[model samples]
Target chain A: MSYHSVVMVKQVPDTANISGQVMKPDGTVNRSKLPTVFNPEDKVALELALQLRDRYGGTVRVVTMGPLKASDLLRDCLYMGADEAFLISDRRFAGADTLATSYVLAAALRKLQPFDIVFAGRQAIDGDTAQVGPQTAEKLGLPQITYAEGILDAAGPKIRIRRKIDQGFEVLEGTLPLLVTVVKDAAAPRPCRAKRVMAFKNARTLLELEKMAEANSLLYVDQLKEEYVSKGLFIETMTADDLDVDLARCGLAGSPTKVHKIDSVILGANEHETIPANKEGMYALIDKLMDDHIFG
Target chain B: MNEKKQQVWVFVEQRDGQPADVSLELLSKGRKLAENLRGELKAVLIGHDVGDLAKELFRYGASEVLLADHPSLRHYNTLPYSRIVSELVDQHQPRIVLFGASFVGRDLAPRVASHTQSGLTADCTDLQIADVTYLRKDYAELLLQIRPAFGGNIIATIICPDSPVQMATVREGVMEKIPLAEPVAGHIAPIPYTPEDCDELVRIIERHREENKVDLKAAPIIVSGGYGMGNFQNFQILYDLAHLIGGEVAGTRAAVDAGFIDHNRQVGQTGVTVRPKLYIACGISGAIQHRAGMQDANKIIAINSDPDAPIFGICHYRIVGDVMEVIPMLIDAYKHKLK
Candidate 1:
């Protein structure tokens, strides 16, 4: 039996490749200056989902909740073989923590119902919270397995996952319609297939179509959207209004957690020694440490 | 202060019938927090036949133990653990909840938070209770969940201003674990196992646990490498020096990510927090996140080719040169001295 998998992906600031201009004077990041990459772990999650889809003879639908710019991430997902993609973006959905995020995601997933599995990265590097996937599972009323390393077996409605733990691994069996949060080492994501890129390169969400229409006066938003839809170049777009969610729980209002304060930590310099890298300096340093009984 | 004492609970995490050190650490920190709020510190120990762990929790400042002992609850299955914790919080309406940021805790906590509709934060470096005003709202005894954000470029203080229960997960060794000189007078209140048929839907078939032999936290001397160590072959020099000096080899998050070192030996905010007696930095340009784990070392010696590396500022000795040159010389010097 084929399974229907919905993989959640995110576009995060490439924290690993920080440039001098990316850091502001206040020590907080100028996030706009930092280049964005498809979050590494999320891409791995997508890869695992794609692999499952390949083996089980099914479709992989990818979803993301971010700014309109996140359509680029969805395009990358399409290039990697996701059969469908959905972007849930709205001004009201800003400043959402994991709980609020899960609210919107679960609503969007409900809108596209009857999916058997929801796959997500173990944690996003931007937040490093790892809460969104499990929270989404809770809201969806599905069992979740986090830190999933690899799928050992999947037959009929049952799937067994080998998940990573503290310095170890465990094999767990869960039924279909469950959530699995994949870790980074789970799989190396396949490169974008050249044929898929040439085909889906023109994929545009409704928001993107509206932008294009605005840029070209000759083009109307409705006509452009219809043309893209007929060409199968449309990325399904859902806004806050489209979701059947309580407004209060959609954005910052629904979020229980708030940022109290931020501190640009500047560590006070302490007294230190300057030792050369030469033989004499190395010997002296090791001797001093030995004298202090720090090393044998 | 509210006349009714606040309820502060720590989820006492156990694996294979042994309590996790981070749980005890939270109990220690929870005691201080409960005191500040004029509250009670309770340890929610949920595992099969783990009633014996309650006394240990009491020793680490838990005044009450809510025991959920059952055969099914022995291993950390998400369904029942989240249900029991969520139901307990719902029944008592606790003010604060703490969990170790371990795999099991991270897996179970969000589900519990979503179920109870409580505010949750992960990997908090510091937790404090404070009275504050925010956005024209006055909050009393809010849990100031402090964590380094944006790749440790800034530290953000987070709070759940609206929710009654503020939950946070702290990585192990972030907080100090100080057990009381004398155990507190606490009693175990057994929480009965209420079955949900859905709980059996997810089953743990087997576990492969590697008894982690790399105790970086307990090591006296740590020869730590970073991404700047150049290559995987360069990382071998660190083990050479570590062996010569009776020390352990560790790596920064970057080195670990670059596949130069294993993650268990990683030292950083996301990795193990180590405060060894001596930490030798090898070609490491330390980020604030990396420093958070090793900055507390009694004495640090940074060896980097770039003189401007951030690690140089915190280290006791700054060796401005290649780690390749410095490490082998140190190893050779040690071998000669021994001879």
Candidate 2:
């Protein structure tokens, strides 16, 4: 029997880059100015799912609850060998904290049923809260294993995994219908296959296809979608309307937490000692540090 | 009908009978927060044969210890640990629940919060109790979960206004673990552990906690690298300088992500905090996350190619040049001058 696994991913700002985001004078971040990338750990989670599919003879489907443009990320997943992809996006889902995001994800998962395993990154760099995976599992009433390093065996209903903890590692065995949150060190994600990239680059959601049809009057959205589906390039998309969701629990309105204040990192004034890079200046600075007993 | 209780819980995370340092630190912080809310600080201690740990928790200011002792609960299996904690929170509602941002706590806290429908904030740098007025609703004694967001560009103060129990996972070393002068008498509250079939679904096979050979936290001097170090091979220059000064080597998150250094040697908000006597930054452009970990160093010397690098802002000494050029020069000069 073939197994099926769903991997949850996210598009996050490139927070690992030091210059990714800038702080405004009002103690807020100018997030629009930053560049966005697929979260690093989520990519690894996708890779693990792909490996499981390859070894155990199954399929890997990726899902992300993000903006409509997150179809770009889903396309990336296709290029990396995902069997199928789904994008869950809606304006009503904005301002969601982890709890709201998990609620929406669990709803989408329920819609896409018959999955044996679920995978997710340990945390996204944007919020770094790392709550959505376990929260989603809780919402779905499934068992979970976090900080997974590698899968030892998954040929049957029971799976063994090597997971990480504080300054250590543990080997764990659990049954199917489990949620596994992956760390970046779990696996080196394979690069996109060139042929797959060329094939899936034109993949678009229904909204994007409609926009395409609008830009070209000769093409009808339905005809365009029919042709795209014939070519296996139509991406399955879901908005808030399509899912069984309590509107109050899907977005910021459903969020229980609120941001009270934001602040820039404050540093006290320092008496900086500027030194030249030349030999004489470098030697003199070394002597000064030595005199102050800063260097032994 | 639930009424808000004046009780704060600090989960005592233990492995093989030794309590985690961050758990004690949270107990200390919880002591003060409990006082501010006019409540008792309860430490939920879960383990086998760790009953005597209650005194240690009390010495760190736990007014009461909730003990859940069972042989199956000896090791921290997420299924059983989270199940017990979530059941207790449902039975006895807590005002605030604090956990360390360690692997186990990060894994367990979210599950409990979700099962109990509690609001949780992660990686908080500071936690305090305050009266909040949010959206025209007055919240008395709300837990202010302060943490950096958006990759450390901004520090946000988050509050759970709707959830009955507010939860947060605080970074280690951020709070002081102050023991009470006169230790409070330890009060034990037993939590029954009825074995459930669902709890046995996950079992631990093998576990290993390695001892750290390089203790960066205790280093007198550190030679830290950043993404600007360029490549893995170039990290040799950093090691050269560190060994010359008899110091340890570390890096920012950028460097660690770039594969320039090991994650264990990372210094920043998400990583271990360090306050060496002298921090010599090489090719490091300091982000707020990196600054939070090392801003307490007695003296900082930064060398970077970019004159506007943020590391220069808090550094005591700034050398605006290529680290590849300056670090070698400093290593050369140290041998000649200090020797």
Candidate 3:
């Protein structure tokens, strides 16, 4: 039997390239000011899902919850060999923490049923909360394996996984219909193929098509969407209303955790004695460290 | 039931019938929070034959131990454990809950919090109870969950104002486990649980635990290399030094990402946070991310060519030189001194 794997991906602001304007006065990050990229660990999760689909004959579908602009990441997934992509975006889903985000993702997963496996990144760099994957699994009544390093076997109804624990690694045998949050070092994500990139470059979500139609007044949104759908280039779109999500449990209102304060912490050593790069300085430093029992 | 009177619960995680160190640490921290809020500190123990472990919690400052011993609870299966914990939280309506940010705790805490519709903050470095004014109203006792964010560049304080239970997972090694003072008089409350007849969703057919070569968290000394080590061959110097000093060799994420060291050896936010007695940074330009994991070490000695590398700023002693030259001098000096 072919295995169907759903990979949850997110378009996160590249926190590595944060600027002074990245943080607002209110303690929340100004995500709009930063350039967004596909979350790094999520790409690794997609790579694992693609490898699973390659070994077993099935399809790899990517699902993401973000704004309409997240369609860019969905297209990138297609270029990297995802068979199907779904963008779950809604205005009501804005300002969602892990809880609300997982609630929406779980509802979307229910809509995309009959999946044998689910993959998610260990954590998103922006939020740094690794709760969505396990929280989604809990909501869906499925078992979860977090910090998965590699998959050993997945041919049968069960999958053997090597997962990272506290200090070392543990090989766990988990059954099918499981959610596995992949670690960053699980596998190197394969580069997007040029041919696939060219083929799916025009893939557009329904919202994007409407925007395109609006930009070009002569073009009809319905005709453009129909053409894209017929060409298998339309990324499926789901909103809060489409998912029948509880309005109270969709966004900022649903999120219970609030950021009380954020401080820009610039770390520095106030009084460090700088030893010269000469042998005398090095010897003196060593003598001091040894005297202090730091070298013992 | 007065929700305010509910006790602060710490999920006592165990492995091989021994209580995890983080569990004891949380019990200590939970005791303080309970005292601040004028409530009792409770430990939730879930495992077969964990009755003895319940008493151990009392020694660490748990006033009440809620035991959910069952055959299915022998191993940490998410479904059964989370279901039981969620049920307990719903019934008891704990004001706050704490978990160790271990592998099992990280997986289980969020699941339990989600099931109970509670707010959870993961990998909190510090937890405190303080009063705050929000929207012109006073919150008398809010748990200030403090944690490093943005790759350790900033600290974010989070509060769960809406949820009945404020849950958080504290990182291991961040908190010190208090010594067993005079054992406080505590009671063990056993909760009866029966495994459901439903088929097991995920079954652990086999578990192969790797032989740990290095326990960085418990290491007394760590000689860690970074990208400045230049190449994979350079890491040998660190290993040699650590071997000489009865320490372990660790690396920064840059060194690990560059394939100079294994991911397990990575010492940073994504890897393991260590608080060794001594941490020697060789050729590492310490970023905040790297420092976040090791800054808690008692003493840090940094050797970097760049006089202005961030590592020097955090290290207790700074030697501005090529690590290649400095490490050799250290190894030679230490070897001769030992003789």
Candidate 4:
């Protein structure tokens, strides 16, 4: 059984640590000041997809749509036994929210030909929306298994999965060509094999070679790209024109949602009237809570 | 003919005759939403003969309760509960459906939402009715559901623009339970939900209650430890202080990662969010994720070796001392006072 799977990965700023310097006067993150890494959960999703490929003989291809620098996570994916990688980088692919993100990912995925399954982390830790997986499923018109903790078994077109619910787990079977979003507890991601890491270390996208050419007059962009492709280090670069994405819906122009404001709220405790457990005291406490909109 | 008003519905979550506190909190919130919309507050209680619990919901401001009581619904089998909820939702459409952000709600809501083709938001921290003027009357058009995003650095307001009925799972204790004001007036409508009409795909082997029951969500006072506690043995001081203060012992994800406590006891973005009356952080350098979970607590006191610990940023009081030493003195002081 040959299993072909594609895992969507993203590089997001570490939103967990916000200091005074996080936002500049323009209210945007000073990207250079913050650490960017492959979303922790998406890496887990990639590991799950790769493991499925490893169990059965198949190819695992990783596809990510972001800036040129976003190729970092793609190379990381290659080092983890991904057979192929594609980076959809272009100036037109900036400021994409979940809705636009799903469109871009689905478009990029279409160019990769076809696959048996698509896996994404339930949600990116940075956004924590849990919307992309379902949105992508909607875009691709596929049955989705969201919050999948474990894939129990896979036989041909049918797959048995255990989805994590709030209380316990739900066992469900679905057909092939489905989108599954895995949770953190799905499986621990394996560290990159030393040999594979070394082999793919010099893998560079075409944009990187162009940058090297601009920096040093002695370097040749075509030769470096050729060498990297031989080593399987080059992430197959794609653009809006390559995916045939409608210019209107490909980036910020396609996204209708707007962030009205980003404000940090410091939650403070309200005035409280403490009382004893007696009936009369409790009544006063309740009245105060109701008055303060804390209770009704 | 009067326009049909949509009713506010609450999913009465229970297990082994024990009602989750989140159910009461949802009811407490449901009462307000119903009042603002000029609708009735209703509870869809599903379980085996939980009719006796109807009065309990009414005490928390349920105007009319709908009980889908049956033997098959006794234990929480998702197939039956999902079917019952889906059936009721189809029959009598609710404007808003609130569920406890517990394991059961997380499972049942998504299945029912998918079944009904409705929108559902999980683990919402804040909920408000957005009023808009239409046809010379003010109509509530959206439920502005808010939840911590970016690991608690910001709150994202989500609206289900197309869905007729709005739904959100409320985190436990995010809202306070309302006290019964002179025994509320309400009626019980027992909707018979039978096993014959349901499909059972799951088998229950054996249900075991966890012995070490430290329900940090319901605890009023919690003394929390973090990575700064150094080792597992040093965490005992946190336990001693919490025990002395008549509170529960909790830990940050760091402590959980350090193997000082189980994952269930972790308090952070990936763990439980607690809003205790008094929260004492022992040696915990608060990260944004950790703060998101416990920042809702009433009075926070920090005891960390470093004065610049981020925990002090949100703490009501800061004790710039080591938890290994400070906690013992506080424990001894309380003991001496008790004596």
- DockQ of candidate 2 compared with the true complex: 0.69
Score chain A of model 3 by TM-score against the reference chain A.
0.90
Tens-digit lDDT track for model 3 on B59-90?
98788899999877887777888888989999
How close to the true structure is residue A129 of candidate 2, measured as C-alpha lDDT? 85
Docking class of 4: incorrect
TM-score preference between candidates 1 and 3, better one? 1
TM-score of 2: 0.94
lDDT of 1 by residue, A172-259 (tens): 9999889999998999999999999999999999988988999999999999988998998999999988989998997899999999
Q: Which stretches of candidate 2 lie over 4 Å from their true place?
A: A18-29, A216-219, A222-227, A266-268, A278-296, B1-5
Worst 10 residues of 1 chain B by lDDT: B330-339
Interface RMSD of each: 1.3, 2.0, 3.0, 9.4
TM-scores of chain A in all candidate models: 0.97, 0.90, 0.90, 0.85
* Per-model TM-score on C-alpha atoms: 0.98, 0.94, 0.93, 0.73
* lDDT (10s digit) by residue, model 1, range B1-339: 367789899998998889988898899999999999888999999999877787788788788899998888888899899989999999999999999999988998899999988999999888999998999989888999999888888889999999989999998888888999999999889999977899988999998887789998889889999999999998998888888778899999899989999988988888888888899999888888888888889999899999888888898989899777778888877877665
Model 4 achieves a DockQ score of 0.12
Worst 10 residues of 2 chain A by lDDT: A18-27
Q: Write the per-residue lDDT of candidate 4 for residues A1-296, one digit (tens) a residue.
A: 78889898878787755566875664445657778878878888998998788788788888888888888888899888888888988888787655677778888878776888898887676766566676676567566677778877888877777876544556767667777888778899999889988888777888888998899999898888887777667778998878868877767665433332344445444332223323343345335434544333
Tell me how far the alpha carbon of residue A233 in candidate 1 is from the true structure, in angstroms, after superposition: 0.3
> Residue A121's C-alpha lDDT in candidate 4?
83
Q: What is the C-alpha lDDT of each candidate?
A: 0.90, 0.88, 0.85, 0.74
User: How well is each residue in A6-113 modelled by candidate 3, as lDDT tens digits?
Assistant: 999999888766666875775456766889999999999999999988888899999999888899999999999999999998889998888988999999999999
Rate residue B337 of model 1 by lDDT: 67
* Candidate 4 or 3, higher TM-score: 3
